[model samples]
Target: MFDRLFFVLGETFTALRRNLGLAFAATGTVAASLYLLGGLFLAYSGISRYADGLSGRFEMRVFLKDGITVPQIKWTAEKIRSFEGVRQVNWIPRDKAWEKYSKENPEIARGLENPFPDSFKVILSDLKKGDEVSERIAKLPATDPDGGVQYLRDEQNLIAQAKDALKVLGGMVGGLLATIAAVLIFNAIRLTVLSRRIEIRIMKLVGASYATVYTPFLLEGAIQGALGGLVAAGLLALTHRTIGEALKSFSALSQLPSLPYNDLTLALSGAGAFYGVVCSAAALYRLQLRYR
Candidate 1:
């Protein structure tokens, strides 16, 4: 196995050396393409996390009228259960509400009479629709006259805007990266096939099968993919660190989550290698048909 591995690698490098300029350019193109893809994915993950965190802060509290009986509360809740975009409608009984309030404001809990109200904490399917959902809940008769639906109306609107911005950025950047990857990989492999055309003909005359002829070029492509992937991973790590540091300088942005470098490195590198190998096989097979 080791002998075969070394032989394949030796032939691969020889092929690479034959077209050093093209090989290097191809590899760099692949690295740059993957780098852009990795950066976009990182931004996608960060924005998604931020949106989730913001949504977590929003829970529509439907405060009940003081005299509404427990049965009346259950009926009101049953109505809300069927409301659109309502994922979870939990009843926060008066005792539970008091417990939560007491922990947060122990002084207030000590001096105050039973000031906590019975409420339903509504978790929506999408927090971006908080305003609409809150509006619907406000009309219910059981809601407290003094306090109806409570939620962060403005923040939900902001989350919706952020989501829109992310969608636009992803579509544009992702499409460009895909185009560059396809063009560069196919062109690179075709150039490799062109460079080795003479050698392939010579091998065919010496009784070499297509398997033997194809192995060296395929191996070269796999190597190109690995090198490109690792280089791109390094570039992505550097960019992540630099940007993370810059963002950390602002206290408002300090909560931004860090990228999982190890996981991303493996994922991106594997994708790059797979692209190279597949492209190499396709280009070589086309060349074989042409030369036959």
Candidate 2:
């Protein structure tokens, strides 16, 4: 068993050495494809995490008409509280709202009348029900007729749409690159098989098993793919570190979550290896070898 393993390894290395240029081309293609895919994965993960955090903190603001009385505001709050999925409702008087605005933007507040309206900050237990709650609140008598209800659901929807577009675009590009890489691997293995045709026929005539004859080519493809995966992993790690460092200069983005390096590496490597094996198998399948 050990002898056969060593023999397979020897033949694999020999084939790789003979087809060094093709092997390198295939490996590089695989690396580039996997790198792009990995980048997309990381971006999708980060954005999803950020979106989830934003969703958790999402709140709806319902503005009341200018002439609304204190009693009317209290009544609106009670009605909102009775809505399903309503978690907590907080009332913000017009004066308090104006004060906050003035403190946050002193320049804008200069010589400006307190144009703020009385509002209720509505917190919901389930963010998915934001539109439903907003619809219900908008129909209230106290709600401002012109854009009384405001929530981050629209912004969240935009984010979700962006994520979907990105996924589709990335999948297309990655899939194209992966197909090119597979073709390169197939050609590399085919060339090696062609070069060793005589030897293969002799082995077949001598009762060599299919596994014994084909294992070396399969191993060669796998090695190339694995090397590519390692290269892509290294590139991703460097990119993550660079981006992390750059984000530190901006306080808002500094809290972004880091990429899962170990998981990505494993996934990339395993995927590359599996892809290579499949391509190699396909190449061998198409070949016609005869030993008489």
Model 2: how far is 73 from its true place, Å?
Answer: 8.8
lDDT by residue (tens digit), candidate 1, 7-96: 666767888887887777667766777787777777777766766665656777889888789899988998888887778889988888
The 10-residue segment with the lowest total lDDT in model 2: 283-292
| TM-score on alpha carbons, each prediction | 0.79, 0.78
Count of clashes in candidate 1: 0
Q: Best by TM-score, which number?
A: 1
RMSD per candidate (Å) reads 3.6, 4.5
Best of the candidates, lDDT:
2
